[model samples]
Target chain A: MNKHLTVALDAMGGDEAPAIVVHGAEIARERFPEARFLFFGRESEIKPLLDASPALAQVSTLIHTDDVVSSEDKPARALRRGRKSSMALAIEAVKAGDADVAVSAGNTGALMALAKFILRTLPSIDRPALASLLPTYKGECVMLDLGANVECDASNLVEFSVMGAAFARTVLGLQRPKLSLLNIGVEELKGNEEVKEAAEILRNSDLPLEFAGFIEGDMIGAGSADVVVTDGFTGNVALKTAEGTARLIGSLVRDAFQSSTRAKLGYLMARRGLDGLRSHLDPNNHNGAVMLGLNGLVVKSHGGASISGFATAIGVAIDMARHNLIHLITQDLGGVFMGQSVEDEAPLSNPDKEASSR
Target chain B: MNKHLTVALDAMGGDEAPAIVVHGAEIARERFPEARFLFFGRESEIKPLLDASPALAQVSTLIHTDDVVSSEDKPARALRRGRKSSMALAIEAVKAGDADVAVSAGNTGALMALAKFILRTLPSIDRPALASLLPTYKGECVMLDLGANVECDASNLVEFSVMGAAFARTVLGLQRPKLSLLNIGVEELKGNEEVKEAAEILRNSDLPLEFAGFIEGDMIGAGSADVVVTDGFTGNVALKTAEGTARLIGSLVRDAFQSSTRAKLGYLMARRGLDGLRSHLDPNNHNGAVMLGLNGLVVKSHGGASISGFATAIGVAIDMARHNLIHLITQDLGGVFMGQSVEDEAPLSNPDKEASSR
Candidate 1:
């Protein structure tokens, strides 16, 4: 029996695809000698990296797919029309029991739409949300629904709070993560009706979550909450604003270092501290977008990501798989069903059927 | 001949209150010996700062005002019943021809309402707006309607653009200030209906504003626009978020410094750079809130300001007075009414009549 960890890698995706995707698979095979990659893209594009993999030197079974997904393709339409797209085929690898997880850097919307159509959301989840870890002053904080679902209802936000809390615990190893509803203000009735209602629901919820009050964009980096949930519009804006601000601040620091001769010397002497700041603010250390709440594991890397960035994302998927995070989330969602009947329980996709079928 | 430059300061306003207010008045008096300030509050509270000010040894006429407005007081209610409040009386001092400027660190809404009600807005301006200078990565950006009006029409935003442009020229010395309407996205038709329509109006307007297009919240600090205009709610949230972010970032740096001995030494070495940042982000230096579209001068300090903060706001008032900023703004506003009839061109205020009355 081969002790292999197989990953279905979407080769024809992202800003620099086939190259970085195949390169990342090659790097991972080096770490896990028994690891196998089922590359999903055209043979002409991925043949170089596939041929370079020592284990696949003479193996015809190594490259499992030869399809490509175009980023410009409309998500829902692409899912229906492009059944053999690289992303679609990669996702199918999980369904066919040929891969432990599927990974992509393709159009996020297409991935999410196709994933839902192919894999099907767990029993209780209406939609699979994207969860990403943010670098906070206190280690890290997890935020969800990054840009998955823009228009959200109060119940959706409440469900996000539950899902995000579970994610932080599984990923960051935090116990009973502090959760907050992201809003412009902290008052109970501060936001739109949905948000205000969500606040009320969270307050009354006994989901084992530390119901921290509303966390503003500024307090996001200050450890106000271990987990934060908001509609995709606000969350995406906040995330991009934070990213843009960090870059702006980093650039400003560089300018300040060269502003005056004295300041330059001052910065030189304090190079260690400044370097620490630069490291702290760098997004690479905290890079990769995680798409959670799906039936199977999937991670989205940045379009301009390098092989190393893809490797980090692959590592995240491996860790998430090792812990059976999505399944664990299904089980832990018990907290949210405390007073509710079976009908009110959030849906969960059973992984046991997937395992037995595999 | 007495060169009494009467100033009515809200003595019972802000957290620091009479202490900072009195200290600032004393400093202003010492700095400009010819200037006289009539502190408005109950005589009992005003007497102590008066006793402290050697220059104000003769403190006889105190207007007998006894009320003080609290932050929790509603804006409209404060404007109504606060007729006897210290801030109300302070503005009344100007209306009564006993003061040149009225400054307060009370509730911003109440200040704008009272300021507009008492001193009146400049002709052709329907609503008065609060403007503040924000620190941009490249330079300074001035924004209007910080919290004065929650909902603004396209015309109001346009007027804000004109007033802000004049303000940047006079206060920041920017010749042709670039103006941007804050929006959800950069596209002309992307933002809210108001913003989309505002962009159209601005694109077609004859105002001398260098309408640079829509700007997001993140770019506000990048000097993307020399002047930014938005509804009060979003603008206030952005302002507060920026202030809070700076504070949060500073705290994070302080903690990073104490993390290890190496970090401590690095921090000590970088103390100068850090200090530069501290001063750079200081709200004190960036204090003074401009009540634009006003006939005379009204400056509202942050409700949480210290004595030095109140003093800084008064300094802005003094500068505006010296520069005849209101008259200049009214004169320059001719651009907005360029092709209007001769009767429409209004002189800001007849200097000869003003002097004779004085």
Candidate 2:
């Protein structure tokens, strides 16, 4: 999608870091050999993994960086101590205009914070949120602020709507992403004051999203709206709950398949159909979480993401680089809401209601 | 659960009222022959359903009433008109000490309005809310304020948590139910100002609940906590979404079973298992929405619920009477918190934003 180009990879991050990360990078590289890969992390840790397979050594470059940022480190501390940190260095590559886009499967908060701190946000952009694609019965549903900003206001929600639409258009490659506010209730008068106010603002805002009125929790998996935008709080709950339920359903289906000889026989007959369903709901196919509304692109992979997840995140980064997603969001939000250019938008305080997760 | 019961049934309330309502009364009558039933509405319409069956001999009385309340009536308007409505007549029967409890599968707003306006709220209660038992992997979870109140404060949430715990224990026969606040995120400071303040109040105040801390959306069906509490805004979302998803999953499974000859054989062999799962997740099993904190028991059934659902609502009402639930919640809240007993606690409003429903 990015026309085969280079991407800055964070090798010393995530649960299965360096190994799974390196393996995923290799898988991605083999598929698109023209795309150059810059691996910035501890060379000692990553080199062996790459050397174990000659194919990975071909398209990937191992940058010598000795520091590693633990997921437990606070975003501010990580960035401050991370000038030499692999994560910070990888992000710095994009900020310094070296790497086209920076990608990581590490701490999301740290990634968003460093991306905003280093590369900065576009005009009228207060915070940059990680918007990810959720696979549903009706294909993929785009949800933003998965864990980015928690205490988001009406204005911040409006910004998310704008940014989410742009991401859906560019990365998701949708014509006009249908947008809906994620509220506790579908009624206009319901929810905390923030949601009611956001509904009014989005109703009048110039964002090109097809303002599909409101979508409730039921409609989320039902596919009522193509792109559902909300503060990080509701978004994270919906995303995690849906993922958990999907996983639970998968487990139950597996149990059913093994419960009896007859079910096992049916499963054997419909192996292809069952496999199709499994692949459709696979987390690996929809892995990358983009930090939307920033001047430079940054994508966070699932920390516990598998190899397929890693490859998907890399492809997402490559795609964003080619499309210049930030430029598009900047231009759109700047012209419509703040009357400034994308590059000129000042950084507003991220209205993140930090969840219990690290 | 109540060995012998008398229930005032608003036969003219729901979409299939008079028919399904009468049918449910008959079914319930069949089980409990001594259970007194009052059919309040048009006598002409109900006499036929009763006369056309062998169950008519057990029909206690046909209390002819001319008024009918539509589902669209706002609570305030419904309260004014309910004076002459069939639903109001039913409540009056409870007030007159004729029936132990009043059950309606009609307008939710009307039922709540009449219950509060006629039966009034418990002294220690604020607003009455619809609390229901939802399906769970563990068993059943008691969740409250599904749609009663919209704009709630922290104090209200604390109260809901208390009321939810008490109802589950007294009626559902749960012992020391673990309580949780339904939040977008589980962090102490993750929710809006109301939730944030409520979390503080719950942390300090005395209530009968176990106070398990904040639980998220997807956690509802997962049986994360025994009792989940939120304002009606969020509770309604969780309830409706779960109901809708259950319906979706049920239909999908049914279709999957009928997809092919092998699938049909699998379905036949596992028919009991599939039926058990269906009944386990059946909305009819969870048919009534209780308006808790009221002076008198008020339970709302699904408008589209059939005979089974209505019968379940009646059973809930009977169970409430048997347990003396209103007294228990008040005593539980007061004994745990402050001021005399919980029965002495329902002041209707707290400055910290604690109202029962909204």
lDDT of 1 by residue, A1-358 (tens): 6556677788887878888887776666566565566778788777766677666433224454555666655565556676888888888888787887888888766777777777776656666677888777777889877666645788878878878988888988888899988764564534456767888888887777789877666677777889988866456545655655565555666665566666666565666665676666565555566666667877777666678777767776666767778787887766565556433323333211111000
Clashes of 2: 15
What is the per-residue lDDT of model 1 for residues B1-358, given as tens digits with 9 covering 90 to 100? 6455667788888777878877777666656655667778878877866776666656324655778877656556776689889998888887777878888877665676677777887776766678888777886889876767655667768778888898988888878889998764464434445666778888987776688998866677777899988866556656665665566566666665676676666556556766776676677777888888877787888766666666778787777766668887888776675674323213423111111000
- Tell me the native contact fraction for each prediction: 0.14, 0.22
For candidate 2, give the lDDT of residue B345: 35
* Model 1 CAPRI quality: incorrect
- On the 0 to 100 scale, the lDDT of residue A195 in model 2 is 71
Q: List each candidate's DockQ score.
A: 0.14, 0.29
Per-residue lDDT tens digits for candidate 2, residues A1-358, read: 4455778889988998988788888788877666788898988888888889788788778898888887766566665787687888888888887788888988766676777888887757776777888765666778887878756778778778888898888866787889898764454544566777888987876667788867777677666788888777557655665554555455555666777786677667655545566676677888888888777888888888899889988888887887888888877775577643333444434323342231
* Best candidate (score: TM-score): 2
Q: After superposition, how far is residue B243 of candidate 1 from its true place, in Å?
A: 3.5
lDDT of 2 by residue, B100-161 (tens): 78898876656776777788776666667789887766778888877777667776777788
